[model samples]
Target: MAERRTIVSGSTFEEQIGYARAVVDGDHVHVSGTTGFDYATMTIADDVVDQAEQCLRNITAALTEAGCTAADVVRVRYYFPDRADFEPCWPSFRRYFAGARPAATMLVCGLADPRMKLEIEVDARRPG
Candidate 1:
């Protein structure tokens, strides 16, 4: 049987929502949509760019715990409440994903929390 594991960031949202932050199944890691709230203090930034960077930090932590890095990412999705907020975060995205250059998409949509300017989800494969 293929090995499977779950990685948690200790965000109350994960327990409240009943979902793991990331799941390691065989060679693939599927990270759940993660927000900008620092799982430690549960505080989020007011600026969209700052929120975008925090979202990457949150996702990177989950990926690390799952035995993969952003460089291993194969796909990524960005969700934003405002399309205008997306451009301001491009530099942050480029910094994190320049190497992986993972397939990417951005969507404008509502989030669970109005304070959440952006959410990010990623899929990665462990180097074989």
Candidate 2:
């Protein structure tokens, strides 16, 4: 059987959340929903676009830590507090996802934190 591994991004909520930031099972890497909050500062950015960019940055950091890259991402889930936030940031999202056109979903929902405007989760794969 393939070994299972947990990838922690050093978030303080790991204990409460009861999950790692990512997990590696053989060639597959699954990343958790990442928010705009800077884990180090425990603060969320104000602007929606800035928040989206930061979320992707966090996702990238997690992917890298898991021995994967954005190019390897096969799926992505985006959560927005409002649909209006999506329009201004489409360009930024396009740039980040330029090479890897992963299957994606975007939804509007309430987040745990009121300051958060967007969150993203990614799934990546490496060949066996």
Candidate 3:
């Protein structure tokens, strides 16, 4: 059997919610939906665009730890409470996913925190 490992971002939510920020199973890495909070300070930007940028920062960290990069991502999921917030985030999203062109989905839905404007999740595969 392949080894399965967990990646932690030291978010209180992980301990409270009982979930890892990401998990690695062999060559595959599954990153949990990450919000805009900067884990270091536990602070989130008020603007959705800023939050979107932070979301990518958080996701990138997990991907790097998993021996991957944004280019290695194969699938992505974006969550936002407001559909209007989506269009404004395109530039931020494109900054990471432009040429990589990973499969993607965006959904409008409620989030755990009212302050959270966006969440991003990704799946990546390490090349053989």
Candidate 4:
């Protein structure tokens, strides 16, 4: 049986939403939809590019705690309210996920907070 574990990022929303930042089950790590807010300051950037960059930082923290890296990521999901904001973030995407080349999906939709420009979620495999 796979061992199940939960990772917390200490974001207030995690407590309010009643979910962990990520979960590790056996060899798989499933990260929750993470926003641009810096967990340390809970502050987000106004620019979509900057927000996307911060999203990577936050997701990296959760992935590291789950014993994996972006290289191990198998799937990724991007969420943004504006379609135009999505294209500008491609460079930031390549910065983190270009090498991994994981299966990806981008959604144009509303986020929980209006201040949030984007959110990222990922799934990674733990290497033996």
lDDT of each: 0.93, 0.86, 0.94, 0.93
User: Which ten-residue region of model 3 has the weakest summed lDDT?
Assistant: 91-100
Worst 10 residues of 4 by lDDT: 39-48
Give per-model TM-scores.
0.98, 0.93, 0.97, 0.97
Please write out the lDDT profile of model 4 over residues 9-119, one tens digit for every residue. Answer: 999999997999999999999999999999889888899898899899999999999999999999999998988899999998998998889999999999999999888
RMSD of 1: 0.6
| Candidate 3 local lDDT, 1-128, one digit each (tens) | 99799999989999999999999999999999999999999999999999999889999999999989999999999998999999999999998998689999999999999999999999999778
* 2 against 3, candidate with superior TM-score: 3
- How would you encode candidate 1's per-residue C-alpha lDDT over 8-127 as one tens digit per residue? 999999999899999999999999999999889999999998888889999989998888888999999999989999999999999999999999999999999999999999999999
| lDDT at residue 47 of model 2 (Cα atoms) | 97
Error of 1 at 100 (Å): 0.6
lDDT of 3 at 15: 94
Residue 44, candidate 2: C-alpha displacement in angstroms: 1.3
Ten contiguous residues minimizing lDDT sum, candidate 2: 8-17
